[model samples]
Target: MAVTQQLARVSGAYITRCRASAAVSPDADPEWDPPAEDWIDLDWSPRFLRDACELAGVDSPTLEALNYALNGDASVDVSVLSHPEATGGFGPTPTALTPASVADVAAKLAGLDWDRVMAEIPADCRETIAGGDFSGDPLAYLTTHFMALRDFYVEAAQRGLFVVSWWD
Candidate 1:
């Protein structure tokens, strides 16, 4: 089976509910299906995006923003991704980011110049990218998903909601 990544903008109340559910039932189901409007289905884009950013020498908050975009800050204690029996193995735990962090990341992403960043990717990195798991134009793929992710963060930040992400 293929593992896809996703993120959701959730209210504080929802986080509390997840925590309560986990505390009351350690064997709770691990399937997390946020409302369609609140979810960002990233497919298999994060790794490619991160690798491209690293190769392009993307710096500081931008790099950090990309990192947090997928690997969220583990602020909550809910084990929403752990279901050994159902999944046959333990997936990554769902992690969250506070509204403030979401805003910070949105700002960083907004500040990035996509074209310049693409041009900055070193030749060796391009070679590595050509040999990567993905086909076609990796930069184009990253651009599409990066825009979606940036928009998602921007909306979440505007709503002052917590963002949760997981791999499963």
Candidate 2:
């Protein structure tokens, strides 16, 4: 139960379970390898964002809020604050993010109290995970990867690009 969330699982090889990529469009074809420059593939997972916000005690417009905007369906014209379409097809198309809708997500992330959030990270993990270095300052390591997610979203928003999250 200690490491029940995705953020807690992130460490060394475990992080590879998830990928966040940025591109000009939704690149659905698996054979089509996106250029390194256009994409930001990370070993980070979605759970990190959610846990980071929760650690700092943030309730309003938390990580769940941002995920809805970025991971939500663009074809459906729903309100920006609405929850993402949880019900969908078997393929990755349902969770794919688009360039046009990024600005709304960026605005939401920009409003977060990053300082307080960063300060909440513990040096040692409270969980009993057997691998990786959650020692000394796990939050320090966690925030490093966590911030990358924030930057990825912001960069995609500025350049009008799209990012998709998935795992094999």
Candidate 3:
């Protein structure tokens, strides 16, 4: 069946279920209450699953196996992904961030060449930087470039040197 047809059928069933549940609920407030039924069913065919997995940049077979392990009809022994050291995985996972590491990150950021870095950044991001929006609030630009700059910093830190400059 076409995806559109499947989606329409799912939507219709969802609406019917919502109306039925709402009718039975005692304190159903139209203003702040959710529509009674929230989830819609979909056929989990291999093609559909595979497309979703590819879009998410994960292996389809691995994701499918994980799903089955998590929710298969017959219960089986399973190990869930968890970090034992952190409560609700809220605290930091163990990793070495020594004084040398701090010095390295600082040195790498200080030594970076603004011209070369600006050239390498995406055109849209460079435009944002050059437009002076970041001039008044440097943190905004830092937040945008944080991931990219961190990667660059890691490589520079490994080599023990980097470059830096200012634009006015």
| Candidate 3 lDDT over residue span 1-168, tens digit each | 322101111122333454455456553311212222321122222233323333334444444432331122122111110122211222222121222432344444444443444344444543344244325433234333433433433443454421110010
| Model 3 steric clash pairs | 111-163, 111-164, 112-163
Please write out the lDDT profile of model 1 over residues 105-164, one tens digit for every residue. 988988888888778888667645634566777667778888999899989999998888
TM-score, candidate 3, is 0.23
**Model 3 worst lDDT run, 10 consecutive residues:** 73-82
RMSD of each predicted structure: 2.9, 10.9, 21.4
TM-score (C-alpha) between model 2 and the true structure: 0.56
Q: Which of the two candidates, 2 or 3, achieves a greater lDDT against the reference?
A: 2
Identify the candidate with maximal TM-score: 1
After superposing candidate 1 on the true structure, give the runs of residues whose Cα lies further than 4 Å from its correct spot: 23-27, 30-32, 80-90, 127-131
Instruction: Give candidate 3 misplaced runs (Cα > 4 Å).
Output: 1-87, 90-92, 122-168
What is model 2's C-alpha RMSD?
10.9
Runs of candidate 2 with Cα error greater than 4 angstroms are 1-30, 69-94, 121-136
Superposed Cα deviation of residue 23, candidate 2 (Å): 20
